[model samples]
Target: MALTKLVQLENFRKRSGSETSVAKVLSYSYASPLLSSPLLSSPQVFNCTQLDDLLEVYYLSPLYALEFCLGFPGNLLVVIGYVVCLQEWRSINIYLFNLAVSDLLFLCTLPRLSWLYANGQKETSPYACIIRRIISYFLHVNLYSSILFMVWVSVDRFLLIRHPTRNHFLLRPKVAMAVAGLSWLAINIQVAPLIVLMFQDMQKAINSSRCTDFASLSGDTNSFGYSMGLTLTGYVLPFLGLCLSSYNIARLLKVQDAALQRRTTSYKRPLRVVTAAAAMFLVLYSPYHVMRNVRIASRQEWSGMELCTRMYIEGLYILTRPIAFLHSVINPVFYFLMGDQFRELLFAKFRQLLRKTGRQRGAT
Candidate 1:
């Protein structure tokens, strides 16, 4: 067996052995297996790091599986409903359609993640390594793209409601398309450093036994600054956008439509989704954001307690992945259940399916 083969069997295939034992097994291809000493027969410990094992069993594996379970049906309905609305696309629905697509793309990657996490991310195949990295790289871009598009949608809603006089300038579908395309381009630029860092320093990452982006960098100012800067941008920019959009939306809601102000001082659903979304975003993301900055800031003066704090924060961070993704699963509730148009679409689809089945039965 090849070294890579041993790596797979020991990890994924769950065949037991130490490195020496596996090396001996491979040595048969090179020399005589029967000429082995006691070292040759010793069992091989897997290439999977201890952290990988713990994360796989305790968090990463379960979260990957759970996210897929929750995400597939959630995003699928949103995508289908979103697609049906394409003929009459507003800027809001356009962004929504894109959000659905991005979420779907992420869902497509979940199975590979589940498999890798189940096997403790040993990365025995170089192709597997490359594929995983590429998926992650695109996911990195999509993260920013999705957030910006979402914020833009909220901002659009804000402008149309709050400043209707000035907002009509951007209400065109052509303009929305251009903005979305440009947003994606910007995200691609932002994510360039990740690709370079991954490809250039992957060997060092593997050697570090930390299977994450931060582990690959050298102990230099440039590397430190680059890593921290990317992480901060990933968090801070989207957060600011969300904050501004939310504030504007709140302002719009408060204005009471000028006409409705005479009748009532309330909203239909009381802004529950808005509050919940904002709260969950902070809860799920803060630990990861905090840890990323702290990791960079204290690179030189590493504290044992700080390291432990970061590890605990990472635990929080891993837990947060599914929670953050749960946003996709939850978003359609507001889009479909809340919207009159989408509800009508669902009913029409149901009626159409029932009619199709009846027609088939009549033919029989």
Candidate 2:
């Protein structure tokens, strides 16, 4: 009887080990069902089965660092230049100020995310999960809020040019401030659900061995309807509004130029503004949104795509993600280049610095 009991205990241990090994294998195999053939199915063989190569770590970490370096100071300058130096606040400046604030908020998250990528996301505390979720939420908030503010800026420009005297109430600085506040509130509310979803996912992954690995697990839906909804509402509609506003502004400028051919040069600045806004939407944001939708679609179980196709989609996502962040860096540059007052103030400040330096040299 003693021998039989010992044999039973040994058999139980073997079964438990096998089950744990299979569970581990299944976790990876589920990421790409097509690669789950019996020949390469064992957990030992697929121990390093990640959805994509670790190459993204090398690619994304430096890009995040670069973005932080450029975006932080550039955005801060915009905020300071508008708030302190410019005494007369135009309606458009209000939108620009809020946009700068949104960009700065997003920039604040980059160092943490960069460190995670640089060292590998090995911080597995529950607090790490909460922090990651907050970062993700604000990232989206800043993105959508920036886009909406740009839309407001374009429309304000249109109103200023197209019906300068008729819509005084619409172009008031107070109205712009109200719109900016509403945009911030709306975007935060929109992204609040994602925070809850991420927390729930973290609960399920509480026992995950590696914190970095746990954080990598996305709670994003693979549903077609959800992807389409995001694309249409978040991207397509705003893009359409921007285009319409830009087109009308261009048309009005052309009409004005034709009416007063000698005043053609006056229209150039406004035209440049429209062109810059359109180019920003086309170059920086469009690809990111399209690639994001494509990546989501590729993850669907019914897609029937091979592993290579999925890999490509994942790579494209990693590549475009940083490109989207470039918008924050570019925005301040755009404001300085396009705003006459901003440029004037920047030059004045530069001359003041030069004078101050010369005085110190004379004293020395």
Candidate 3:
């Protein structure tokens, strides 16, 4: 039965084109129960160019554009509010402000990505690939930077709750600024290797005409190991830190509730903030990381229908990319929620401007 299918596929390939190779080895389980576990000596290689291009055009392009449009206003407002309205900066404010800046930078890269995805087939210029590589570098920079900043924000909030006196050295703005600078340096260090890998991928004839996301780049064996290492240090550690921070805050809240024999709304706010940050991390980051690892693994040796399944996983990975970035649009909410003084000051500034405008109109 396998021989019959093999002959048929060979004939089809010959008729299609000699240059195109679909699958070197095919595995099928449809014949009978015994054929389900049939062993294959070699791995199957299926070309996913068409699928990649299709998803790039239809799936990623529109999503990136929409994310940029929706995320820009909120992130810009947060940046402006932090710079103009907020008179004093706290540790959380510094962290959240950095996060807002990171989101804005990330969002700024999306339009170029969208255009690349939309017109990827036509983009053959060397400069375009260079721009894509640079954009990809900054995208990861902002992504992991935002993650680290949020982790700091959560930990800072927890410490503030643990010590209401606010005497924690790490809670100082200068200390926080230094931490933010180190966070940027750390994320850049983590993402620096990607640009080299992406350059090597561009040398491949398969990737000659296009640039792909790091997970989607083939022809490089080192990318898989690098990706695993990146996921570990860039995401896993920060996620764990966030979880620990949230857990400690919750425990403190519980102890306070029990000791006071009453549930005070004051403690609940920090508890809610940390818990929400943790929830956001889980909801947004987890799937992207899981699917990214899976996507990389899918490029490994596999045969038959498993290759087809990997194709579907690739599509799912593509979908997760934009969803993970939804954090940019959502971070502004945190900006408003985490910084009471910022929010209040922002509203007051707006009100003052409105009153001035009203008085000027009356004078006219």
Candidate 4:
């Protein structure tokens, strides 16, 4: 009877173990749906949690505000300076004019970005989300368009100095306009898919106000690829183009005939303008592009960097981004300081404004 009881006890233990195993399987079955749900699977939800609030408030907000304050009027003056001298618009000036317009459009988005940063991510309305996406779209448009037009200007200057008689057809005002239009079209086409993806992602986040945080997007692989591609096309290639153009122009400036040099004294201002532009691209824009790539890499799953390292990269990106915005303000300064024609026109406009104010005062 004792042996029988031992057997029954062992059997009971096996039954209980089976029951426990079955219960675990049932629990896992029930939990799988929850794990697979969109809310749980969405990467943005986790990315948003990881975002450094301190970086946004103390650094990005103030910098964006400062950029807005300076860039708006600065870019506006550049546009006005070009516009006031419409009759004098050459192929090169057309490119510069478009660059100023791109900068102005970019500056328009800063106030909204500033407000978004200052307020933090509250529950964003759908309209607000749409507006933010549009702004972000144009921000990128401005960036690449500016780079492209600057390349055009550099190439034009290069040809003027290096091969003045080779590409006479390309130096026409109509040809410049056509090139500018084609550039705009190409950029818009490149960015259209990205805009669509952004909008779709924003729509999915029904209550999120963080429209500008691309780091919070789904699919790390896609984002990483896009960022890398943008870095290459938008920055690396253009920078190489500028460097080559500048080098050629510099060599030509050094080795020209004395009579040709005397005749080209008027070209000194444009040469200075081109040199300043190249320097600006190197100093202000290169760091931002490098940091942007680093930041994007840190956001990827395979980066394998520590949290502190990632945070450092994020901070560096924020700092460098504002430096890029400084280009808008500084470009106008380049125009006024380097381009005698731009300065003359700007001064004439100011004088006309002052005279009008005096006339109004006298009438009053």
Better of 1 and 3 by lDDT: 3
As a TM-score, model 2 comes out at 0.80
Q: Report clash pairs, candidate 4.
A: none
Worst 10 residues of 2 by lDDT: 11-20
**Candidate 1: tens digits of C-alpha lDDT, residues 1-364:** 2454456433421211112244443454235453233343322222222333576567877787887788778788878866664357777666767777877887788778878777766676666677878878766665666566667666666656555554576666778788888877777887787776666556544543224434223322355566567666766677677777677666667667655655343342324444454565676567655555454444333332322233444444455455555555565665653342666776787798899999999999
lDDT score, candidate 3, position 64: 95
Q: Each candidate's TM vs. the true structure? A: 0.74, 0.80, 0.84, 0.77
Task: Give the C-alpha lDDT of model 4.
Answer: 0.68
Error of 1 at 40 (Å): 28
Worst 10 residues of 3 by lDDT: 40-49
List candidate 2 segments past 4 Å from native.
Answer: 1-53, 164-167, 209-224, 304-308
Candidate 4 lDDT score at position 139: 77
Better of 3 and 4 by TM-score: 3
Inter-residue clash pairs, candidate 2: 121-212
Put down candidate 3 lDDT per residue, 201-306, tens digits, no spaces: 6776343555667776655547678889999999889989988988898898888777889666977787787778778878988899899887877665432234
For 268-301, candidate 4 gives per-residue lDDT tens digits of 5556667777788888888887887777677555
Name the runs in model 3 displaced over 4 angstroms.
1-49, 219-221, 301-307
Ranking of all predicted structures according to TM-score, beginning with the best and ending with the worst: 3, 2, 4, 1
* Model 3: residue 244 alpha-carbon error in angstroms: 0.6
After superposing all C-alphas onto the true structure, candidate 3 shows an RMSD in angstroms of 6.2
Cα lDDT, model 3, residue 226: 86
